[model samples]
Target: MPTTRLSKVFPEELSEDTIHIIVQRPPRDLEFMPKNKRIRITEGWKPYKASNGKSVDLPPSWIGFLESAELEPDPRKAFDYLKNDLQAGDAINIPSMGQVPKDFGIHDQNHKVFVTEQMLELWEDMRGDKD
Candidate 1:
């Protein structure tokens, strides 16, 4: 049998609500760090500017969003939010703190952002559910 399009199952508005991510580079800061430390290092959702003084638009803040996966204080389900609710291109409009440091390895101005296999690998690794 032929398969139906995703749009047919979900309305355009609902589908459009999803974020479109084009993986440019692998995720950053996948380590489990203290929230305070993480906050200190992070600038939230601020735009990144290039050395040429142009606003650099990066991909959706999946790392920031998933960083809070275990915020519920439950061990057994520490990563349930990430494993179940979140998808690759979910809408992530959180305000970035400002700009990340150049050494962060995510500041490359040339790479285009999109979803990549490495991202999924990192996601599973971050969740600590890898076999």
Candidate 2:
């Protein structure tokens, strides 16, 4: 079965300033505790940002969050945030957000980014849902 993959997604409607990156809390792995007994750090995507400036740190599984984004002031700080306070910052969710495709075709270097009609529609509704 051929599944749709999106390497990078930049909804045409959302400008560069929108905080669209969705990050979840880092998981805890402990030898003392069984995998099932281990605490679930986060159940859903946390309203996290990579930098205070708009983007957020995401794992390789979610690396395809953004297709093309201009870097903010400091690149180093953003990396540190990933290590330290990824989900520690914002703890809210932007409604109207749907999961972007995760299977970003690892075999291909030229990552193909697909912005579907549904994605656009989902993003378009974000503003209305914002409290």
Candidate 3:
């Protein structure tokens, strides 16, 4: 009998089943835990003025909340609250919030949680359902 060569078939992309498994896994709670110190403005820091002539201060207790509250890992949600709820103006608070330190930069002044591209990629990798 003559022998015939078998053609090889390759997948164009990863299988949807594999992708679903990777994305459907529950997100780690530690991944979403806030890992930064919160700061609240005191009375002495109240009525602080921004370069734009807008007041940019928080109540002492609220400052305490900012400086102490557990932050959400999702930068979008965090920023949304910061912009809408905190209203720290575009100066001190905004800048500080937007530029959280490397150890605490999970959120941004834009109130974006996990705003970095890498973070988004991680989110997709862990939650993508496209299969």
> Judged by TM-score, which candidate is best?
2
Candidate 3 Cα deviation (angstroms), residue 53: 54
Q: What C-alpha lDDT do the candidate models reach, one value each?
A: 0.49, 0.41, 0.43
- Ranking 1 against 3 by TM-score, winner: 1
Count clashing pairs, candidate 2: 3
The residue pairs that clash in candidate 2, if any, are 49-56, 50-55, 50-56
TM-score per candidate, chains pooled: 0.20, 0.22, 0.17
Which segments of candidate 3 are over 4 A away from where they belong? 1-114
Each model's Cα RMSD: 24.4, 24.6, 21.2
Off by over 4 Å in 2: 1-103, 109-111, 129-131
Q: Write the per-residue lDDT of candidate 3 for residues 1-131, one digit (tens) a residue.
A: 22222222333544544422222355655555454322221134555454577877656665565455465244555444332322222232322333345655344444333244564456467655856
Better of 1 and 3 by lDDT: 1
Indicate the worst ten consecutive residues by lDDT in candidate 2: 88-97
- Comparing 2 and 3 by TM-score, which wins? 2
Model 1, 30-109: lDDT tens per residue? 36667766765674554656557786544336444433453323354443444554456553322223343355436453
How many residue pairs collide in each prediction?
15, 3, 18
